[model samples]
Target: MRQTIESRQAELNAARLRMLNKKQEAGDRRQEAGDRRREAGGRGRWTEIA
Candidate 1:
């Protein structure tokens, strides 16, 4: 019973790490896309209102 609990805990920890990694990757993509958009249009173009 103790071993089963430990294995379950390990699996939970692994899942949490995977989720965190995916979240970080998404944030990086968002930042990179934002950077590209700004570069494509001039500086401050991202914040300008139509």
Candidate 2:
């Protein structure tokens, strides 16, 4: 019975780690998208001025 409980706990921990990794990846993608928007906006302003 105790072994079963330990195994279940280990599975839950592994699932939690996977979820955290996914969240980190999503955040990195969001940062990259923001960087791209900022770069595009800068170019747009330069074109408007010219």
Candidate 3:
């Protein structure tokens, strides 16, 4: 029973780690897009007044 619980906990931890990594990747993509837009021009394409 103890071993089973430990294995389940390990699986849960792995899943959490994967979720965190995915979140970080999404944030990185957003930052890269912002950098590209900034490089092209200061005004935001999405916003009308910026």
For model 3, what is the error of residue 14's alpha carbon versus the real structure, in angstroms, after optimal superposition? 0.2
Residue range with the least summed lDDT across 10 consecutive positions in model 2: 41-50
Every candidate's lDDT: 0.84, 0.82, 0.83
Strongest candidate by TM-score = 3
Measured on C-alpha atoms, candidate 2 has an lDDT of: 0.82
How many clashing residue pairs appear in each of the predictions shown?
0, 0, 0
TM-scores across all candidates?
A: 0.77, 0.73, 0.84
Sort all candidates by TM-score, best to worst.
3, 1, 2
The superposed Cα distance between candidate 2 and the true structure at residue 22, in angstroms, equals: 0.7
Q: Where does model 1 exceed 4 Å of error? A: 42-50
lDDT of 1 by residue, 1-50 (tens): 99999999999999999999999999999888877776777456475433
Candidate 2 lDDT over 1-50, as tens digits, reads 99999999999999999999999999999777767767787565443331
Higher TM-score: candidate 1 or 3? 3
User: What is the Cα root-mean-square deviation between model 3 and the actual structure?
Assistant: 2.8
